[model samples]
Target: MNKAYVTFRDQKSRDRALAVLDEFRWRKSTLTSKIAEAAPDPIVKAPEMPVTLSFDPDDKTPVNEKVVKSTTPLYNVTYEEQLEQKKKAAYSVMRKLGNEMAKTNPELQQFVRFHKLRRKGQICEVDDIKASPEDVC
Candidate 1:
């Protein structure tokens, strides 16, 4: 049988380790609470109510694409094109948030393993990773 030896430099080193552990615990709890708070509340059933639907043939109107094109300025864009632009903008924002979180959060960075995993073509889910300040130590 083989025995392993373990040692701490002094009382201060032990205290520091304990402090780091406590901080990690506190941060984990805080993250849990924050996640819970951010989650959507469960839906509850309410008393059922009768609903009515009505349609009128006169209300139906066809969109005039030619008229729309004539009215739009040469530089103006369509709604579908604008929506695609917005989606790209939102994606960029999410990527920026992920980068910022990776920079600030060590546990998240660990979970991401950005240096190792990025090379392997793996990406982290931003919301799933929790980081603690003690991770830096």
Candidate 2:
């Protein structure tokens, strides 16, 4: 076993020890504050660039490319892309509904055929089928 003994010979020695402790405390506080003041502020970065997308049904996968338009932000581009996706989904639902209607209404079939012919650059009549008022009810 080991024992250590600390002795203050007189009041003067005790006062000197206290003064050293006080100086050490003051140094520590000043050093801490100095470090805090010297610390640099955090850095902020700009958001990512905007993207423009094109849908090609023929290809197995979708293609996307980044576009840098003047006066347009990334968030706006993303929002526009979302709206375009929604429009595409709505069109898909409309086509499905048209196909279902073609079972009962031969007129819709002719309209669909007409659109196909028009897409192929052939001259076609612009006849659109309308449901009878009674059928709607």
Candidate 3:
């Protein structure tokens, strides 16, 4: 088995990698629950507002204003709820991907484990294991 360490030259790459890992973890844990929670609720059309206009003869100007109003759906979730739902979805995807990777490249399994360890500062070196030609699924 080969160990792989997570490294990025820039903060953006590091952040992106970390986010991907987090999403993967979430995907593995609560995929079904997240999907069920995110299912679309009953759709309702928003109420339209009336438009009013006024004309000023002195300046020969027409002023128009629209009163726009919106109502939240009964099943609408809060921002925090939405974020949690997203995190769950991400975890599900990550879990699936990890499983696929394990099947295709058994060596990569160790790399992922090492990466996780490195992330926690529990590991210092990650061996770069090359996959066998037959294992390259």
Best by TM-score: 3
- Which window of 10 residues has the lowest lDDT sum in candidate 3? 30-39
Q: Model 3 lDDT vs. the true structure?
A: 0.50
Question: Which candidate model has the greater TM-score, 2 or 3?
Answer: 3
TM-score of every candidate:
0.29, 0.27, 0.30
Q: How close is candidate 3 to the true structure, as a TM-score?
A: 0.30
TM-score of model 1 vs. true structure: 0.29
| Cα shift from native, residue 37, model 3 (Å) | 42
lDDT of all the models against the reference? 0.51, 0.49, 0.50
Per-model C-alpha RMSD: 20.3, 28.5, 26.1
Tens digits of lDDT, candidate 3, 1-24: 223355569878766666665435
Q: Please provide, for model 1 over 90-133, each residue's C-alpha lDDT reduced to its tens digit, 9 standing for 90 to 100.
A: 55666666667778876687655664356332343333222345
Which pairs clash inside model 1? none
Model 3 residue 76 CA deviation (Å) reads 2.6
lDDT of 2 by residue, 1-137 (tens): 22223357886886676566443545335211111123343442223445567656676542232233333334445555755666556556655665666667786788766664564422233233333465565
Minimum summed lDDT over a 10-residue window in model 1 is located at 30-39
In candidate 1 the C-alpha lDDT for residue 1 amounts to: 29
